[model samples]
Target chain A: MSLLAKASAAHLAQLMGPLDSPAFDWLRTPETGGVMVRGRMGGAGAPFNLGEITVTRCALTLRAGGAVGHAYVQGRDKTHAQQAALVDALMQTDAAATIRTTVLEPLQKAAKDRNDSRARKAAATKVDFFTMVRGED
Target chain B: MYVAVKGGERAIDNAHAWLAEERRGDLGVAEMSLEQIREQLSLAVNRVMAEGSLYDADLAALAIKQSRGDLIEAIFLIRAYRTTLPRFGASLPVETEEMACDRRISATFKDLPGGQILGPTFDYTHRLLDFKLAAEGQGGAAAEAPASGAPLPHVTEFLNKEGLIQQEVASDETPPDLTREPLEFPANRPLRLQSLTRGDEGFVLSMAYSTQRGYARNHAFVGELRIGRCAVEMEVPELGFAVEIGEIELTECETVNQFQGSKTEPAQFTRGYGLVFGQAERKAISMALVDRALRWEELGEDNVGSPAQDEEFVLSHADNIQATGFLEHIKLPHYVDFQSELELVRKLRAEATEAMSEAAE
Candidate 1:
């Protein structure tokens, strides 16, 4: 998993919607092995290392320039990272209520279903506990 | 068809059941009680509390019993439990001068205001095994003399009057919590001292011994070593005042070390302090010696380049729980990492053989 690349201050301001811009900007570049997302925590002017973390981030600018949605995933799933980043960027806007109902909840439900299916498949292999007894009689 | 080994969870459950059965031993034998372990194995409980950095005697005792008397495992249990508990508030610093001492002694002074009380010490006891102790219920409680009229003031205070020892100035500054925060290089005294107090006894002892064997040796004399109970207090924001939460037994060590004058500063005997949970005098003393050895840089002495002087190494490796966990975890399944390594080695060997043949041609 690649770390998110950093973004310049001017680009960050232009990218995110007005009202409550994130203190930091992460890069959402897709690499060969996996998607790399880097976190830029805290506000500008005195940004120090939060950490070089493996993440995937995506940003979507809405129509009417009212909202910018962003999402960040810890590992290298590009689509997941993009969706998460989009959610983050959108949550800052006035359209958060609609997006939450239409997107975030559904995505979470889908992930849970997929996880349950995988868990069932794994559990199928579990053998019942048994003990064998031997006698010389 | 070989279905890959996929019963890790089931195997783990079975292993746990087997372990429980093994721990219980024969059904005819009675199970060990928590009270029995607490009272009989108090030293193990003390070690757990010392390493765990928690003061609850009952919890420490329980942890010792659950961990089968493994001090390090008990410490790990306490530490894990401590993380889950919410910290309501920090308490005011306990005044060591006012400590109700059980054992107090000053190596620097022969006679001071308070006469030395060598209470419950193995210092003068012969190393030969006491047969009486092996035979249970052989000893009777000794009658207590009324507690000495306040500890005869610390010996270091007298040296402070002579201007020979540096007078320590107290500050209202708050120190960072090491457990909550990631450690950085060049830590302050509070953080360093905190790490030393909960550090592994064997590791601290080795580091302290190294300093004496000419590794960053800053000749130190034990100014005083005292073991006693001190009350813990907390300031209640709603109540608008401090409240006494509880009391804990502690061993405190203060070392007076030779501090040759630096270019700008005058020569005076500097201090190295150690404070730990319970009556662990040896650990406290070792910690004090190591603390002094690590202070060479701050005191403007030459960098002797000793392992004890290496702050990053000492602080990082001092904790046995972290060290042992990481060390023992290698026994767990690492097939993926090993497979990758195997592939890389094969590739390298093949490349090397090809190069050797070409070179011969």
Candidate 2:
């Protein structure tokens, strides 16, 4: 296999395409719990529980061959994974048309579908609370 | 309308579930037994054991299986496991002269005391592929010699008596383990030699060959190369004396190199050495040559600008696991950094375009 196929998490982080938010902006936001992803070396098999490694993984595709790229870190950061995957997919192909049709479109659709579903579910449970007062003139 | 997306925990759980399902695909097929890996994939096990600095065949096999044939991962597993293992004490150096030989040969002498037993080597065999193995047919049974079980004498002992070879003076000084200690610059001979012994076979081979092809051309003759089983002994604090822990097969290579005496010393033969796990003759021989070449500084010889002469380069880059790990880790993510670079590039281009347009007007 080519060297790219054997790339690791640290390398993946460096190759990640673009940041969604500026560093200052992310820093300004309130600190919250992070995501964790865990994986071990080996083909996905009856994997012996090789200790739980906390990882944050994000996935994004770019306008390239139907390349779905994934970035996984040891902690939670959906944005990081997404950007990493986007970069990976972008690195795979130079043809913008293929990238758009294959990677970017699917990722965009998936993101939209996810957002719409969440909005629909949240809308169902929306509660409006207000006090009505008659003005005494 | 927009909603904050959160399913990371659920997604991870689902992905793991899918991965597990994928790993054990079509469960109807016979699962691979650990013994099958140990026996069939013996070479893989050997590599893991050698690199991991662990000798357990079963554990090595399991690591190999767990790694899905990734040797470095298996080595990593073995190393991690080995670190956790309680250290009782260090083992005494095995008396290789007393080694029960399966194979012993000397290039310096036509006939040695122990005699040149060809033993089991692929040297004489034709390079043609065996059709029977391909067809999964059993090979011929191993011809067992009637157990003579005689103690073998070393080829070097004879030279030692005649004062032709330099005798190693016994010292109580403890040699440091390269794995335990971080490698420092201007490493001592012991430390440099330790790393070379456990170094990658192919890498060491090339370095040694480079010496032969006039890179560091130190005329090396394989004084002796012996492969055999030796008993390992560990000292028990309570018990007072050392006791036999176990036995391991080893390949020991000692090479006599041509050395023209430098300014301070008289002309005398010097030695290149290799001691490694298992019966790896090629690795042992290569190690010996490299070891000799590396000793140029201490032996008061001219520093012939050679790769072997560069101690830091040889010692640091010799490990396959470290080299592979650093090389392969580039696939992770760095979109955050990339975006910054992208912004910089775009900004630069915009500034350049505006400057050119103003000049034209």
Candidate 3:
């Protein structure tokens, strides 16, 4: 669920590789909303309202199997919400293994690679701070 | 006094239509894409998100475009859009200690764990404008090195461990939301932080600067300023556990201040913290300074009568949307009120004339 939520909507749609004709019926139609994000004071203290982030959420049941699924993704991408919910529902069905290999694997790998590259770039900027000394000692 | 005057329906519609045309600027110029604004004009988007109190880069970019690059106006658009959203629920507080830092530096320490990384910063760049950029030229590539990806320890934590600095108390109580409830006097630290995070950058910066100029001056050191990304997570009732929904770039500043301890306890360093949306370092720094000034009372410091120390005054005027609404509303027609004032002046003049004549007679 976390990986799916973090995955880009376009990426998810591509990984989904086209939907079955009405693959899942909406238990609750996908909708956009806001979620007030909080942050702690001084990083370890009481929480405070930082601000709100747009969220899109939905619930659905698979057409083939009666497995119900729910998703809450960041941002106002309703289609992304539907795709995430679809993935959630499909994961519970007999196709769980196939979906995990195709969808979940790629998303996780991409996320890791992106994080690694960014960390590397940041690490490059770390100051070595070579110390220069006089012969007084 | 204001009077309702109707009917500029055609003019309003035409003005809007003209605005749409004006927004296009030159037909020859390629229309600006949201992606371009999000990427290139990221700082602008960051300010809008910070002030607008919403952290959606695409939406912020759209607001910037629609407002024609006016940040305050862009903020207004975002604030307007925020009201239309259905709030699902509040998320658990974000743990910034675990942030994947792109840039992290400390003014107090010469070197620390997760060494000072000056990510993409405008700090050392000469003020000279590069003409190559004007011609849309590409810059040189950046160098990359291996990273351990371990969480960088907070610089203040070092001071904290030795009891040289005051410790932050953890609380389970939920902080009040100013949007949900009206801001009242003697606001708590959490409320002040919230207001400061979303406060107009210019206003907050000025207030912070005033502190540096000796207004409620709190001797401050930038204990740490880090720009990075953190995961936002919320608990799923069905799953009965928290899950990461997304990630957001953040700038966190912690200012260690000189604390003259009260009679009850010995003196130790105090803290003023600032955390905001995106890599908005300037605002974060300023916020930390002002936060320290505002903590004067609780820290047992003197009430030095500074603007930053006055929470009601600062928070009340910090919102750009409210400030602009009140300021801009004056441009609206006040004909009826003006006419009444004119009549009163005329009446006074007539009375003066009658009194002079009677005195002469």
Candidate achieving the largest DockQ: 3
Q: Candidate 1's residue-wise lDDT over A43-85, tens digit each?
A: 0011111101123335455554545444433323555544445
True contacts kept of 2: 0.00
Name the best candidate (by TM-score).
Answer: 3
Which has the greatest lDDT? 3
B1-361: candidate 3 lDDT, tens digit per residue: 7677899999999999999999999999999999999999999999999899998999999999999998999999999999999988888899999999999999999878878989988989998989999997978888899897777999989999899998999997889999899999889999999999999999999999999998988889999999998999998776788888778889999999887787545799989999999989999999999888988777777786789889888999988999999999989887898899999999999999999999999
Writing each residue's lDDT as its tens digit, candidate 2 over B187-296 gives 87667666776678889999999999998889999888877666554453533665443456677788888878897556777777776666678988998899889988
Collision pairs in model 3: none
Error of model 3, residue A25, in angstroms: 2.0
Worst 10 residues of 2 chain B by lDDT: B141-150
Q: Model 3: per-residue lDDT, tens digit, A35-57? A: 88999988888999999999888
Report the number of backbone clashes for model 2: 26
DockQ of 3: 0.89
Off by over 4 Å in 1: A1-137, B1-5, B26-29
DockQ of each: 0.01, 0.01, 0.89
> On residues B1-361, what C-alpha lDDT tens digit does candidate 1 reach at each position?
2236576898789999887788677899888887777677777777887788776566788887677667888889988876754444455666667666667788887666665666567797779987878886466654444333444477778888899976666654555567668878897666777788788999999999999899988788988887765544445453367544344567878888888877655799987777777878989899889888777777787877899998888999999989999999999777777888999999999999999999999
- Give me the runs in candidate 2 sitting further than 4 Å from their true place: A1-137, B1-29, B146-150, B351-361
For model 2, how does the per-residue alpha-carbon lDDT over A1-137 read when each residue is reduced to its tens digit? 01221123343344333323212112112111211111110111111111111223334444323554544322234454444445545556564465456544555565445434533333332223356877876
CA displacement after TM-score superposition, residue B54 of candidate 3 (Å): 0.9
Cα deviation at B289, candidate 3, in Å, is: 0.9
Query: What lDDT would each prediction earn against the true structure?
Result: 0.64, 0.61, 0.90
Fnat, model by model in order, equals 0.00, 0.00, 0.91
